[model samples]
Target chain A: MSEPNTREITYLEAVREALTQEMRRDPSVFLLGEDIGVYGGAFGVTRGMLEEFGPERVRDTPISEAAIAGAATGAALMGMRPVMEIMFMDFITIAMNQLVNQAAKIRFMFGGKASIPMVIRTPAGSGTGAAAQHCQSLEAWFINVPGIKVVAPATPYDAKGLLIAAIRDNNPVLFMEHKLLYRTKGPVPEELYSIPLGQAVVRREGRDATVLAYSVMVPRALEAAEQLSREGIELEVIDLRSLKPLDQATIVASVSKTGRVLIVHEAPRTGGFGGELAAVIAESEAFDYLDAPIRRLAGRDIPIPYNRTLERAAVPQVEDIVAAARALAQEGR
Target chain B: MTEFVPHPILDPAVIPRGSQQLLRELPKERLAWMLQKMCEIRYFEEKAEELYVRGLVHGTMHLSIGQEASSVGSIAALRPDDLIIHHHRGHGHTIAKGADLKRMMAEFLGKECGYCRGRGGSMHIADIPGGNLGATGVVGSGIPTAVGIALALQMRRSPQVLLAFFGDGAVNLGEFHEALNMAAIWKLPVVFICENNQYGMSGPAKVMCAVQPLSVRAIAYNMPGQTVDGNDVLAVYQVTQAAVERARRGEGPAFIENYTYRWRGHSKSDRNVYRTQAEIDEWKQRCPIARFKQLLIEAHVLTPEEVETIDAQAKMAIERAAEEALVCPEPSPENLEAEVYAP
Candidate 1:
């Protein structure tokens, strides 16, 4: 029972539309980051925002990532909703003190007297051969932090809706956008809407196995599921829009029906969000339904290489996901 | 070997111009009030130190013993609505911004009635309704936050300004430079006050910073900078007043380096092995409270008996606050998980 006014738009367009609509709707919301104003962001997600909102609201900051995160936190404490861009997700290490220590801990440390209502939007995942320093999927790092909400939107619809929800939330949210999904088009409604955080969507329901993924992995999982259907293997693909406050009920239900799970992500296999996902499934009622070990098709332990062939080899592609799912399905008869 | 030559701009004795003019123009009540507030801070810290010695206070505490004038004078120049963010040594800043003594004491005592409900003890005391954004234990962590608040003020076109208080130790921090540059370029309404207390824990300012006057770094950000005699209450007040006015007028951020001293070790665990007793004694002679008291007496702002009464009253107030705080209950375990996020 949704509206029928849907149009095809790229993921980047959806993100830009969400920012424009939120900034227009609320006076308390503003954007700040390096090269965001005149440069329109490194990826041009903020292009034309400077002309629409002017330089005061659309601020261009120095190349200091710490200041970008810290300033957004301070502004949020003063009752303004700030959406800051970190340029690249890997550079978040420079601003870790502000994001992890200050922004994440302020509200709790202050006994809830302060609310850091802010959003940090950064491009994540490995693709485009940006190398190790520029390309990374750091959502797991933020998901482990107690006081912050982590969101990784896969499609144009989730990107737009989740970005709006992140801006409206009363807690600090880390919105991770994949680098390669910027231009991918999907059917998106042209109205301002918010997809609630901590919800999962059943992209492709199946009975054989469940493929759990987020961000760019969702599309790849769907692609793998489609190809596996022709091979008589039915895979259920669930897109986890939010990492923290995870939609465990959906994941558990899918795993209970399929009796197997194949977790996929672009971050390294060691200590990635897939580990948390596997742990959540293992610790839940779905553990008894598992026929095989919860396999994770994730990026290799090595840093993302710059060469196209090695970069492609680092993270799981659609064929890798299909192969992993096929092997998991065939395990134990 | 090069002789230990002091830079001309870092000279601690160089007073600002129009000090006498500032003192003459100020009302007697205002001068007395400044003096009384400084006394309150001194007495509060003395009580806190006594409590720490008695094992009544937990955690490490940083005392701004000799920098009271720098905190009180600069805060006195701002409107009550203006915001402030302080560093770890922020008890004086909190009291100067008019936080209740009982709550502040309770915070140190780790009682539930404290400002942070006993969560943020000495280092993170805050009074949001009173416009104190809160203090941070991380060095130079609060600088960018001040810029952010100033940016919010500018975007909203609010008439309020923000004052960011940090130590000389924070000058070398990357965020400090980044924040100043952002504030300068955006012309945000903020005043960065560096309480140059001569030492960053054990490291001297001269060793930490290569520049002569720390305020001169403001030139890199294209903002006005000044160094004032921090012990002189009138001089600090005047310099801070001009900066606050410039911010209010939308001229941009200004940096003020108040050259002061810390009469005690950096923290409770410090052994004072970094400097000599003679050096400590030299800085002690320039005690902000004593100098401000002498100024008030000379200006006929308060009689010697009135000064004595103010001192006695501050002592009594601190004593009462400490006594009351000792009886407050600890936070309940039933609500241990509360307040992690907004309701």
Candidate 2:
């Protein structure tokens, strides 16, 4: 239950509130991105922040993603908590060296003498008809690299708290925000609160089967679980909040009790994060309790198409999760 | 335009100076210290080569044996607290910024007592407390990194300046232009120094770059640019000192191209197939340390005896550092991932 004064706000607003509160509380917190200052960010998450913080704090940089990312790494070394925004997660491919090689490895390369207190906030996943170049969920790309924290918040509340935690985190963090979730409203407190990184929240509890989801997939899993409960087939929907330093224990417990699991995401399934999750579960003690072959419900191994119907078919819909979970629950009994 | 002057310092006019004003104004001890640091880098690099040849050191090393004067002279202009973030070929820059010879050597030897606890080897030595922010082996990566640190300092309203060092080939990198524009537009306190070592690895920078005297790229970014004879310690000192003051005063960033050469190959794996032997011998005749030693003796800044004593002390210092580093314990395997994330 949210406390009093906890008004319903969109995921975008929660992110802005977290940033606004942090900047007011600390002098070092600042924002940087293309057209972020005057244009108020591509998604309007930082709208009106420019007027409040002034030009020095809310900087609009050139369209060079490499420079923007590298500059964030540098500023973080000197004790500035920089929150840099990339226009789209797809464009982050151009800035991979800076993010993966430099920002992620700078601390360990310097033997931990350096603290990169920075965040790379970008809009990830697809549904806006932005097509292939603009729509992609690139969290798996970042999770592969060590020394950087990765967060994908499903609810407005988690978005605010997790972003605050990322900003306060002394290491580099990649904050992946789904484009479609910006308008999704949920109860969020007006006061500032931070959620610790690497903690998973079980959105729904059931014993029939386990559904592992994150970011935009969590809400879909919940809808699917609600449908499955009508047929007396209940699913425990878990939101894996932090991708790196993953909350493996929570996943193991749910899998051990349920005896079946379904990992879901919107990214292509060929080399997706679901593979990593499956390996983690298979290697853990949860493997002994599994009653069925593990199943994965993820995006097709193709780019997110421009057509609305094809796009919907590319990733898992609520019905897809319901069907996948239903199949897992009935098998190996 | 008629001919590409590979070593521009051989020409008197190409030095780009009215006079040796800094050499005249600097105290006797400061001048001696500059020369002393240059020698120390020379001896240290030579000892590193000796260790590499004897199989004590693994991995390739980018030895800055010929560019010591460029490093020593420019770093001498900054205060102890000022910062520096540099590129791959960074041994001279690290030592000139006051790296403990023993700790640096231990790092080279992959010992636990090393600066990075044996995590980062030769190309990534960092002395954080001494203002050496660290170096990356990635080409041209330090450009925006230096600007970032400078931006942080600017936001804090601090007067500390940063010196960014890269090679001649870094001029062609997109990060160079992007970072320069950011530093210029933000008016960041950064002094960009490009050690034009004539070649980047085996690729001739002349063929790689469309621009001669890469500092001219600074014009596009609206920053002041100058090229100096990197071998002339006094000339490099004069140029960097002015740029450091301009940055400290918040006048914005400056681009300085120090025309020098690397006596050794790019790294230990270099086959020496790109450049001619005669060209290498000719540049060796223009050795920065030897030239600086002659200048100091002729300028009466130090007697011949004093210069020899400094050289002898440097050699002995390197000897002592290697001796200490040879016996240091290796980093334990259990603690490999302990430093991946900060506490």
Candidate 3:
């Protein structure tokens, strides 16, 4: 099958397109999870899949996340690349044993004779006001586990490319899709391409301060960077596409050039992805280029409340990111 | 229909001679092989207990003291290509799946010659090439992995079956129930073997399970379930043979509850504060080893002299394996980070 010519689509469409393309390419590839078929998906990412391939290939499993994950892991080990659609990112906690214990460690425990080439796609981040249970940015949980690759794509280009790459990779990959960015559009190439799992992309170039962000935070950081540009604060923005195998080189390069760094994420400030980025910079040669202690603008440690105002307050808004960037830019080395 | 009595089926004195025809059917050579494997497992675990007490085995040890029949007999029914995922009390399964004794001993010693290259000690040893995927310290975790392997075999059009072994405690876990349900629904070629050794480390199976028989739970998943004499090697072997054949023939997964008892505590450090000594004595009387030896004697397959010779040979083999493992070099500190992930 030839690649689709649509260059611009929603993040959800990009994900659906990736699944469609991969399923067509490999007979062993299948999708299973709640509401992934007939109903399209909880987020409608798998809409029309049932019509295209039917339920055998695009299966709608029970509400048991553990079973869904275990089934995917089993299927993956049996020479199938199962792409599982977790309805909500928070529900991933229910399947941690299979994801963290079984899927991630099987290959290594079996001395590399086996591999779980499975991908778990879930909608993550707060902002939709789905509350604490449904909306969460739990990519950090997966980052700590070995043998599995974790990717949080912020753009349609990345969403499609990385999904394709994950399906093809020889290890388990957790693909966390931002719930807020599913409808957001970006230019994705028509040719079949893949963004490597551990590589980071420079979203913007600047010289004053390096703004590192991931998933939904990338767009917020980009919006803040646009406003900061007018104030003569050239903010360099980095999209950490893959959290597990973090692209430390890109982060260090930008920090080295700008001499200032500010990390931003939707997860809570304490023990969040920002802490990892901060530690990486502090431990790397880029620490010498610091103009001030690295600042982290992140969500407050609390359940994502139901109210819109509280939800917005819990996460780092654009203004909050802008203020943090200004503070890093003005500080002395 | 004959009414089933709730008793350890390995008690040859109670079981009618006709009921034990399966145990006597094995030829002399096969009986000797089964006896050798049971002795290997028993002696290996006995040695492991000694090493653990002396603080030589680094991690916790889940020894298979009195439940050798489940692994030895059940695994004997599987082909070399068939896969098995063992539990923490998995040395029997590993050896039954054909893991090398030298490497198996070295693994407990954390030597470079260990099957996991010293990364995984007793509880986590894995030999994938030999068809033993690995043993999990976490209960019920291997059930899903085995189901997945069976699913893989079905996809590849292979007739190989997957034998997933877990303990009585694991059956209460959601993963166990979920994996079994999925395998049943998909008609996946897998056998769910529950080594019901009376207790899950102080928690007796009777208290955890509402129904007396664990095999009855399989009907809920719409699959064939059976209860076998876990202590009797022949009964365990016959039931497992039927399950494996059913799976290979695309008849779907089967549930098996092997009724047995563990003579050791849950782990090495366990002091028997949970149960009474009288109960242990009661189970020890029905030990599968003694029952098998008696049956072999009555069948004229082995005399007293040969039984002693076999015991001596088993002891010698253990001494040689232990000596080699003790002298084997400990894994280099530089190799500590190895095998964490595939490069």
Tens digit of per-residue lDDT, candidate 1, span A148-225: 999999999999999999999999999999989999999899999999999999999899999999998998999999
Q: Give stretches of model 1 more than 4 Å off.
A: B1-19
Better candidate by lDDT, 2 or 3: 2
Q: What's the TM-score of each model vs. the native?
A: 0.96, 0.97, 0.93
For each candidate, the alpha-carbon lDDT, in order, equals: 0.90, 0.90, 0.85
CAPRI class of candidate 1? medium
Which scores better on DockQ, 1 or 3? 1
User: What is candidate 2's TM-score against the reference?
Assistant: 0.97
TM-score for predicted model 1 compared with the true structure? 0.96
- Measured with C-alpha atoms, the lDDT of residue A231 in candidate 1 is 96
Give the per-residue lDDT of model 2 (tens digit) for B1-343.
Answer: 5664343222243345533555577898998888889988999999999999999997778999889889998899899999999877898999899999999999998888888878888988998899999998898888878878999999999989999999997888888888899899999999999999999888887888887777767778877788888988888888888889888998999999999988889999887899989999999999988988888788787899999999999989999999999899998878667778876
Model 3 chain A: worst 10 consecutive residues (lDDT sum): A1-10
Q: Give interface RMSD (Å), model 3.
A: 2.3
Error of 1 at B119 (Å): 1.2
